[model samples]
Target: MMAFANFLFIVFLLPSLEALSNVNPSEYQQELNTQALILQACSNVENLSSCLSNFQGELQKSGPPTAQSIIHAALRATLDEASRAIDTITKFNSLSISYREQVAIEDCKELLDFSVSELAWSLMEMNRIRAGIKNVHYEGNLKAWLSAALSNPDTCLEGFEGTDRHLENFISGSIKQVTQLIGNVLGLYTQLHSLPFKPTRHDHNATTTKSSSDKFPEWMTEGDQGLLKGSSLGMHVDAIVALDGSGHYRTITEAINEAPSYSTRRYIIYVKTGVYRENIDMKRKKSYIMLVGDGIGKTVVTGNRNFMQGWTTFRTATVAVSGKGFIARDMTFRNTAGPLNHQAVALRVDSDQSAFYRCSMEGYQDTLYAHSLRQFYRECEIHGTIDYIFGNGAAVFQECKIYTRVPLPLQKVTITAQGRKSPHQSTGFSIQNSYIFASQPTYLGRPWKQYSRTVFMNTYMSALVQPRGWLEWYGNFALGTLWYGEYRNRGPGALLSGRVKWPGYHIIKDARTAKFFTVAQFIDGMSWLPSTGIKFTVGLGN
Candidate 1:
């Protein structure tokens, strides 16, 4: 019995001794690796030593840390700075200020509010990974939100063009530091494979359906299926807008106001055959709202607001959707504020998981302001001129027709002005399997932001496309940073011989290399598009 007790002592004590013996070699080496990787991430960041300090406490607390954890800490740091900026903006607004100062401050407040939302979104995505809800698209989504958050301060500074430099100085320094931190985090995220911890991915089954027996996807109810099938019988029409006294609401706004907030199921609003001239809006609370129409041209929602008419570009949408999971089918959204009335927007959609099928957006400039979030457009007609398809949304357009109208002779006809401000952002124009028909001489797009990205794949471009293919936004700006690519495109203007020779422009050599911009890889559309009943190809198809 004495020998057995002594043996147990030796057995337990050895591990402790062994742990102490190798602690310096193994653990210290791991910490060194962690520090090295994080330091590499802090490359190009201002005040590198201060930025490294933010990770010190987080790194010391745990075993080895991951890029994910580092990103979470980075976001926390960014949010704190942004919150302080908000407080400063609010305090400044209450003080005595001129009209220019007031307007600029108000605009800055609104933009900072959006930046806060973007940070919140980034945090949510990070937390989702922690909650074990693994998603391949989480990286893409986080990049988009963080990039937008970083760009907000820059965008706010743009709004203060004529205002005093003092006001811009107030928010610029603090927010600029915050954006630098965000950029550092994004740079770290690119090394996720090198960092520890792989997300245990699970199948995202929320937007996919398996229905062999029905004519529609399983997520669709009997009523919605019937309505989309060209009959109103058995249709669960939540609201209807008609010109005569034959519907639930006379105007589209009335029907939108009636939509219940936070609805899990769809609230179908059927608009009858009429040109209902109204600027429609759907707020954030009104999720899962479906707008069905009699037909594309038959049911029109038109507005004539423009920047020239004293309205901001954001406020000029004929139909602005801010809800999540919004769907619009068989409709035409138009802004009659023609080409001369610059910056007129026909449809402004900033909704997540929004889908537009078989619709038409008609305007000369800013035809479709796909402002943000994940969006899908299939079989739609978008007519515009001069930086029309603009915004920083992670958007995809499949089998659509994009027509360029005549712009002011001096006003260059550029189809897209994608505002992706960061290299890591997943936001860009992925025009795949589409047609670009030009009524005037046009360029494919110009870099709207430093790291702007736009890809045209498996599409046809008309001959009127300018020989240079892409025009520069400004002299020597974004020429090396922007990413513009073309793959397997056909037609008179698809030739690569005359395309921009910028370092960022690529004539993709093969399908495998170009697959990164496909529907499946870019936005993870396969997880959602099946439910929308939209025809989309996952990759370069025969």
Candidate 2:
């Protein structure tokens, strides 16, 4: 923990270091090292002077604080700042001049609300770590939640892109401070979390399955794995949704609303074939909910809310999921707002340990929003024109079909806009053994944040992907920092001769190295995915 001895030193602590001659040399050096770590943690903050002043002479001359204390203090400070940010956003929510700005402020309020929750969760997790209950699960959850909290500010600000800047300018400083504090705490967490990732082949003692094999997770049963194999009509369902009066509910939203909250067992909702024209928002409180539809195109959930219609990109989803263990199969989510609507999303998922199979997301821009946590998609059809498949979640798309539609004339198109802000955060988009069918030429992805990461492995790409496989967000922006890699991709667009020369782009010729981006290692799906009833390739085995 005292490894940051050579890191940045605070100006106020120089006098104590200068007086080291009169004290025990090793003891005084250790104190200075601790002070140096604190300074280094706050050094990269956007508002450095303000963050340094936040300590308020807390560095006493008596003794050095322990590493655990430093981590807890940082978490507490971040939580406090996030609470204040929520207040500032709420005040602005009451003062927007125009209707569109008010709507944008509403979206801001929702985003800040989530940020506050995540910050509080971070504090609780830090308390657990302080109590000597640290592990890889605790560390992973903290990283994901903190990273998601850090991204809300940018998304909140983006809602006012074409509107007046009054509300934007008013909340910018407060939100930026929250992001800075989040980044600082992330840095400190990376230094403090000492555990390594559990091994890929490590067998977890799963008590849920009866076979005695270490296959499925303790949360999933053996019968669950056999559900997706064939028709589940004989399977017991908690609710039935049909357009006709034969079923229990007429609308899909009604059935979803009736779902049990925080359900430990899978609460299945079988939806009959019909076009559901509803905007459904599945909140985080509803966990372990599974939605089964008749089939893609037969079971459609369509909406027209879009950014051009005064709805923020964060709120334009036809269907949004924010719960844990959300599973959806044989469904189609569609946004009929057309290409001119700018940022309409069909399916937005903020869910954890979520899986989608045999589904389709149709739109012009931002069709599928993998917003946070661990997600997996298999054999799905995703269609869009712009940066459609985007977000900060650690997601894996296996055996899926990605179709790039024609964009508006003179508008350049990109496939993804991954929003990863911190390097330590285990969040990225991995397309494995899939196909990219493009109707027009497009770039692979542009970095939405400085630390964005995405990779395409063993995927087939059409010629419309263009010779320049990757695009830059802007000149000299995240071009040098974002990581973009392609491994063993086959097709005319996968040629490396014409790829852009960026420091972050890689051809990835090594075999073992490519395994790091697989479903098993990237999203840690080996544990939870075995009993999902969806077929997935765990690793890139020879």
Candidate 3:
């Protein structure tokens, strides 16, 4: 009994032994390591010493702390902060303010309410882990929940942008505090998972899937694959939009309107070489529709509707698709609205089992909204300024080129903003064997939602990628909970050493773990992608 008591003393009360003159050497060393790791993680915070002191006390109560315990406690702490924020924001909303301020306050209140739920999600996830479920998706779900929780507060503050309110200073301070705490959570997670900032000894190797003759379905004939791979002019076309009155229809919409509704067979629309300045809406009933264009430069679909024109951020999409099994090849979808006209979306796809091959989506902000469901982009070019490629979708950009346009002075750029609001969503952005070129300093992604998940595998990142690599959405604190990772990437911007010290970003050290984000894992691309004959490199692009 005495020996057991002594063991408990060493494990739980060792931190208090530092003042004792004759502490056990082994126990003291153990305490030192625990404190050192905690302090090291908090170093990125401006109030480092205070953060350390606060965590140290919490650590003492946690017993013999493991990585999981630390994370659990951190989540609880964040929940406390979130609760305080909800209370503060709620009180502010009750106070008298201008009609515009009230609107902003209402938006913030809704965001904060959602944030509280997200934080609760983290706690629920933590509870599941503590219950010893240890499922494969356990950690993934936890990360997602934490990420979403962190993003909620930041988004709440974003609602007040450009508004003149006396509560701005106070609100900002409160949000930053929550942000810093969440950052600490992420930093801690990073430390436990990937040995933070230090390169592991594991070799970065690219893994590929096996190729076989029977890989594709029986319906996908070689002739169909050949037509999709090359130019489709003069081929048997169900309808054509020549823009020169020579084809079946003058506009793409007219061609679509004429096609047999709810047809099981592929309705191919051959768009001739010309810039079509029109908004295209592919309704849900339009399934198995294929848009074959005359090449990216020759065939262009452009629009300029923006929030400044009183368009909702979502409705601003130039070409919005809610169809299933939709395909577009060798086309350019452009939103001509410049950066100043924020929230302009060029292409918004909510289609399931959609494929965009050798295409281009161009704009300044929110260019390609991979809205939802399963989507694939191969050998395509995506150009935008901030969060140009964002949405809550299981989309994979394979062998595509992501171009970041120059932003106005004092403006930062982000390439992807994946919005995976829930852990069970199984949605994210996977850019494999792609190349990212930026004219201005840019980040690989910012969390549009808390559980935002994104991975860059075997991609080439240019010098334009900022040293930080990933940015917090205007001080959003999701580093601990988001799923951001880089695997065996090459080129100047592939340096992980200079990347942000956030906990959510991972430097994948092995093929098994890296494979989790592959085209096969993320979107089950192996099943349908081969049928298109459009090539996709799977596994870890080491």
Candidate 4:
């Protein structure tokens, strides 16, 4: 009986043990490769140890790792550690992989060229992060080891190559999936790190020469006096109060109430970073007053004023500026009332010669009311749904972004509903070299009055714009005198052949007539504006 038992053990149990012991050569090789890749990819000591510990456990459990499984495990483990760290590692892997995958996508051959450039850009970003990591101080020896690993070309390149292949193969199999993944993962990273990559004065000057329409001339020059003088001019005010460290007053209206009358020199108010929830009314004496904030997105002034809330369409404004020469920069004005309510104004600039630079005006309906005077917006973002940028003022939008959100039913209307009452007012809305985007289909312009005028010149119109660029307000017959025209507009929505036949729109067949709207003419930009650190074009030669 003992002999028989021993034979059974040898035949069954021994074979089972041996089968478990014998690791596949391919899997063993793959496991080793995966371990090396993970080690090289680790950004810090803690992450490195965590990755290595996970790998050891994985190896003990599986004996060996399949190439695909190992790669997947490594990525999953990295992502589990830290959100930012995982993003950095995945982006590093995606460059070459994205390129390979994009090339293999069916019917995407035409887009391959753009994909290559994008891949190169991702590589550059990875290189930059690697370089930045060296300067970061960590607690221990992990930093030294990570630095050494990054410097080792063979190990780094090997891991990079493997990840590249994985991405390429995955993307090739499902182009849309890979594209979406890359966009989500890398896009978030890019957005998080966007501040570092923003263009500075030096960068901008190196890229584009001084044109007549530039709003930042002082930053473009070699003289410190220009900057100091501009600052002094901007800082000049009737009354001043250092807010201690408070950064902001109790209310914007309080600050204005404390301000001296028009007889006093222009009042200057400097606000710090904080949410100011109050409606502001700038009377006539507030002329030449400047309101400066830390940043447009950071320093926010918000309210819930809409036409439906017992306030007139003109009175329901978070901020109503009636003072002339009112300049506001680096501040956000927002209205909480949504588009469904209609005519929710975040800002109503009724003052003449009022300018907004590097600011943000946000709301749903009638976000910005350029009610009267000459207004200029440079590098500003204006967001709304219906008639977001409107009024009787002669306003110029230069290098700005216009956003249109979806509106409720029966509220469908134009993005800009210009209300110029007469041509003698020298009032119109001119959008120049700007971007117009809509969350849903929208008309470019609509007549709000008898002689409403709006012009889009050298602008980018997104496909969300309706086929007919202009719409008559309430289907009014008086729109025959409304001037709605487009010159040198690019994008799918700027098809002029399909536009409405309005007498006010001049096809602009010649360059001479078009020159009237150039940067120089818009601001008479070459004279006083240049001293204020602005440069306008002399002619089309720019």
User: Which one wins on lDDT?
Assistant: 2
| Residue 83 in candidate 2, Cα distance off native in Å | 1.4
What lDDT score is found at residue 207 in candidate 1? 26
Steric clash pairs (candidate 3) = 147-450, 148-450, 148-451, 186-480, 186-503, 206-542
Shift of residue 239 alpha carbon in model 2, Å: 1.6
lDDT on C-alpha atoms for all candidate structures: 0.76, 0.79, 0.72, 0.56
Cand. 2 TM to true fold? 0.88
- Candidates' RMSD to native: 8.9, 4.7, 11.6, 26.3
lDDT of 1 by residue, 205-289 (tens): 2223322233466666776676666666777788988989599999989999988998977788989999999998787678888
TM-score of each: 0.84, 0.88, 0.63, 0.55
**What lDDT tens digits, residue by residue, belong to model 3 across residues 408-454?**
67878999999876554567888888899877888999998778899
* Deviating ranges (above 4 Å) for candidate 2: 1-23, 44-64, 195-226
**Cα shift from native, residue 436, model 1 (Å):** 1.6
The predicted structure with the larger TM-score, 1 or 2, is: 2
Candidate scoring better on lDDT of 2 and 3: 2
Q: Candidate 1, which segments miss by more than 4 Å at Cα?
A: 1-23, 33-64, 94-107, 134-137, 161-166, 197-215, 230-232
